[model samples]
Target: MPVLDLLDLPAACPPGTPWLGLDLGENTIGVAASDTSRMIASPLELIRKTKFTQDAERLIKLMNGRNVSALVIGLPMNMDGTEGPRAQSCRAFARNLDRIQPVNVAFWDERLSTSAVERFLIEDLDLSRKRRAGVVDRTAAAWILQGALDRVRDQATWV
Candidate 1:
């Protein structure tokens, strides 16, 4: 399937296929995946920043292993709902991925996702700063995926 908007994701993916979420940063790429039913998302792994080909290869390997059918990448929009450099970078990454992989790709507005997760880890989870840093990316990826899943569920109710 081709790339799609978050709101345009298919109502149902193939059986046993799951969606992957990505938090693409300059230094690392956080990964998350949904269950087959798409009810929950879990933090998977963090890929260190590398050349585009290397990053794409690593992502494809993970997708192959997890049977991922679609990708939901966090789009970092500005506070005023405008696209910025970060958002452009994400879109570029998606374009590159689409060229090399057959999986569907989509972007989800990810304003404050990382900050929110960091706050939760510090205040509620009481995790140390170092520990939080290690897992924040993956956690943010989960947060992004969960938001997308919730939207999907809500849309299902209307059908």
Candidate 2:
């Protein structure tokens, strides 16, 4: 499957299968997974940055383990709704992953996702900086996945 818009992702996804979410950073890839019902998402694991083949192999193994049929990858976009280099990198990553495994892929605008998770960690969880650093990426992956899940659910209601 090719990279799809968020609205189109739900259709591409098979019923009763989980959706994997990825927050791709320069040094790490934060992973999250949605429930079979697709109503909730949870942080899963963090994959350290490595070669593309290694990274994709890890991701494919996780997806197979969890029976995930689609991916929601966070696209780091500028505030003004423009794609920057980071966004392009994410797009390319999705495309490359599709070529390797051919799973449905979608992009969720991830503007401020990391900072929002950081604020939650500081104010709500009272986690120290060091603790936050260890978990922030995966937590942000959940945040991104939750946002997409909510949108998909709401769209289903209207449809």
Candidate 3:
């Protein structure tokens, strides 16, 4: 399916299936997954980007193994809320992902997600710079997915 609104996910996917979240960077793809209850998102791992096909294959394997019913991809929009080349790249990756694996995909606005993760790591977690770099992307993926889950849960009461 084409990318859907984050709010549509609850209805579009199986109730108890976990969702996969991705924070796509030029050098790496950070991965996260929600629990079956969809209440929390946790970091999974990072995929070092080599080629599109290889990356898609790895993600597909992980999603299938984890019973991921949908994907919440981070869309890095400009500060002024306009989509730039990075957003376009994310969309392209989503399209390609679905073509290979045929799963539902959604985009969440990911402004400041990385910065937020970095801050938490530096201030709260108090990790060294090298250690922080190793985990920042996956942590950011969790941040993005958590934001989407919050919005989706809020919309559930709209009846």
lDDT of 1 by residue, 1-159 (tens): 466867677643575689999999889999999998888999999999889999999999999998888999999999999999999999889888878887788789999999999999999999998899899999999999999989988987998
Prediction RMSDs, each to the true structure: 1.3, 0.8, 0.8
Number of clashing residue pairs in every model? 0, 0, 0
lDDT of 2 by residue, 1-159 (tens): 677888888788778999988999999999999999999999999999889999999999999999998999999999999999999999889888878899988899999999999999999999999999899999999999999999999998999
TM-score of every candidate? 0.95, 0.97, 0.97
Q: List candidate 2 segments past 4 Å from native.
A: none
TM-score of candidate 1 on Cα atoms, chains taken together: 0.95
lDDT of 1 at 136: 97
- Lowest summed lDDT across 10 adjacent residues in model 2 is found at 1-10
lDDT of each: 0.90, 0.93, 0.93
